[model samples]
Target: MREVEETLAHNLREVREKKGYTLKDVVKGTGYTEVSISRWETGTRIPKATVLYNLAKFYGVSVDRFFWR
Candidate 1:
């Protein structure tokens, strides 16, 4: 479970960066703070469903892609 969580975080960060979005951009788009994004990316915290939805919309990707391949 921990490994899967970490993988999700890593993939999320990779996708965000690949799209040229900064933490500030994510915050602006998803209304989540930079600290939260940092925590999520570092696997220190798990994002809530709403937040994940917002992130997926902001990145124009499916929420499942953040977890699954």
Candidate 2:
């Protein structure tokens, strides 16, 4: 993965883990499919802006958190 993608993937996974949530749990909370969240966590796909915002809000984190990690 590219550096930015890697950081985002890592941060997403880390935050989810820290919150004790599974991919399925995120799906329920965000109204996104588990497959899509898994792809983002694996750096296989980047979320669109709205999706990213939803995920950030779901995780109670700022969007910048994904980039910084």
Top TM-score hit:
2
- C-alpha positional error of residue 22 in candidate 1 after TM-score superposition, expressed in Å: 0.7
Residue pairs of candidate 1 with colliding backbone atoms: none
Kindly list the per-residue Cα lDDT of model 2 for residues 1-69, writing each as its tens digit. Answer: 599889989998998999899888987887898888899999999989888788889889998888884
TM-score of each: 0.91, 0.92
Lowest summed lDDT across 10 adjacent residues in model 1 is found at 25-34
What CA RMSD would you report for each candidate?
1.0, 1.3
Tens digits of lDDT, candidate 1, 1-69: 998889889988998999999999888887788999999998999988888888888999999889875
Q: What ranges in model 2 sit over 4 Å off?
A: none
Worst 10 residues of 2 by lDDT: 60-69
| Model 2 quality (TM-score) | 0.92
